[model samples]
Target chain A: MRIILVGSDKLTYFLGRRFTSKGDYLTIITPEEEAAVDLSRRLKATVIAGDGSDPTVLQEAGAYQADVLLALTDRDQDNLIACQIAQDRYGVPQTVAIVNDPDNKAIFEELGVSVAFSATEIIGSMIEQQTASEEIRNLVPVAGSGVTMTEVVLGPNSPAIGRAIKDLDLQGAVVACVVRRGRVLIAKRRSYLHEADRLLVISEDDQYGQAQKVLTGEGA
Target chain B: MVSNLIGGNSSASKYIVVIGCGRLGSLLAGRLSAEGNSVVVIDQKESAFENLSSEFSGFQIVGDASEMATLKKAKLDKADCLLVVTREDNVNLMVAQIGRIFFETPVVLARVFDPAREAIYREFDIDTISPTQLSADSFMQKLNTHQVSTSAPTEGVA
Candidate 1:
């Protein structure tokens, strides 16, 4: 496949080296003269020194014929714009970007980019997997922007314990599912919260604080 | 005019938020406030507000526009119109997108140095002013006019 890389980061360099070694058509665009020269020498790919966000620079780098365009620029906007230009103008089959802000991946996806990879999302999920917190566990953020589903275990001394779900002020959050004593329980308004009950709640990003306050009652 | 564009019929002041308190942002905020509109100017650097006119009665916020919390503090969701004039194109684009898409502000505009980067804004139906393109066009037009009027070869230093 004819692949185009729009930045000189480690990921781009690694991909460029691998593609060249395998004899695939590869091109790289970077704004640094020394980095372009070095990449060209080491990776044997056509390297252009200019802002990759510019359509003219991409045109000069033969973006029209690229089968895949990877916008790995450090800035999320640059990456998004570069991928957009490749997809909209050049009609590249595949367009991907590396987003700096995890929240922007959803926006990029909505804008029609094939995919967006965010380091923050990856690292955040990794940390979530590794965390040993007894109250909150495996909080997997969903869709990158607004909502996340997580497991929260209420302690014996918590305020929500023994209270009906309807009584809790969980206006901004949802108690989607609940597990108690190795059996799945129906999560309804009348359902009662018990000590050590594992609740699967989905809440918006900004309302996580309110959801935590409602469930844990620590903000009292 | 701001109230009209913001879908409000009230003759009262409309809310305008300007991100980046640089020269252009400060001037805009000052002018809007002088017009009796409620304005808020935000910048990461507190010193940037020194450029604002003393007569300006708008609120000043010192924080990064890239953060959601900062934008919330600035009440961006309640803004009738938002102007993003940050030096970085990415920050401006992101903030403008949020103002337009998330907050559904009536008017969202930004200053982009790279004319090429304006395509993304155009795709999202956001407005952008490219100072680089505007200045270059004006300068080139003046240069051409001067050249056409001074085509005579100098015979001697008179």
Candidate 2:
């Protein structure tokens, strides 16, 4: 996937690194030359020094062909404007914006922009998960929201992985997505899971323990 | 000779270097400096110092804290503590990890934006603060206290 990220800050750089490592083409746009230079060097992604809110800059960065455009600038207005330009002018299929101000998240969503409240929702969910259980490795909300989906990579000794999804007996959780050796498999009852395969599960707040037990095979 | 050595050591105050001088970094530096501990701040952006306390009497360097050269320049090995308060949680984590794992600094604290990433930071066994979660809780508290005023008058008032 071709991903264009606006801003060269730490979050943008982190995402750029993650996406680039996954074989996704990434281009980062930053107004500051130092940020662009630093992030470009760190992530080894194409860094364009220009105003992300400008259409000309977006064109130069190949925003039109981008599969996903992330407007992650520090300023909320800049992110919104960038998202608008990417969606409206460039005709990008998927555009996600980071809403620094949680209050403006609704406005961005209303405009049909996928919004990630990094400072609020993302961190809030993680804090909730941390308080819930220690076994949760990394909890990333897919598509940046809803259903509270998380990816859990089973440990080597985990008892649940060898067992089929149905045999794991997940009481209140549903496996939504699974990734085995770069192959994405939608969760199914018949899916015979493996030890190293990454699993994406969605469950209620109360069911987190059961979900963790099923994922980690702690109970088994 | 013993009296001269004791007098010389008593005059030297403990110094701390804070890397990634953002909001939390600046705050910690300011607080520590105010308490008479010598402080030095290092940040990639030179403009970040604008928010720093004027009363803080400390050296400020504009450079990446992750770089070994920068760390050496900041005197990490000699500093009593290294505080990593960059906005990027990863950078802060890396800085803290290096301070603890490499330099074996006595104290290392990092600012972590994602509370979920705390486990990873804990694996490194360094202190961490999640500013984002605190901000969210503050917002939630404000929302709970928010009151809506209706057009209707009170029972005793017109």
Model 2 segments more than 4 A misplaced: A1-220, B1-13, B140-158
> Each model: TM-score of chain B?
0.86, 0.76
TM agreement with the true structure for every prediction: 0.68, 0.37
Error of 1 at A70 (Å): 1.7
- Deviation in angstroms for A47 in model 2? 20
Lowest summed lDDT window (length 10), candidate 1 chain A: A129-138
Q: How does model 2 fare in lDDT?
A: 0.75
lDDT of 1 at B28: 81
The DockQ scores of all candidates, in the order shown, are 0.20, 0.01
List the RMSD of every prediction in angstroms.
11.6, 24.1
Residue A213 CA error for candidate 1 (Å)?
A: 37
lDDT for each residue of candidate 1 in A1-220, tens digit (9 for 90 to 100): 8999999778889988898889889999998999999988888889999988788988898988999999998877788778877887888889999888777788788767899989888998887666634687647888767888878889776788989999988866899878998899879999999998989999887788888878987642
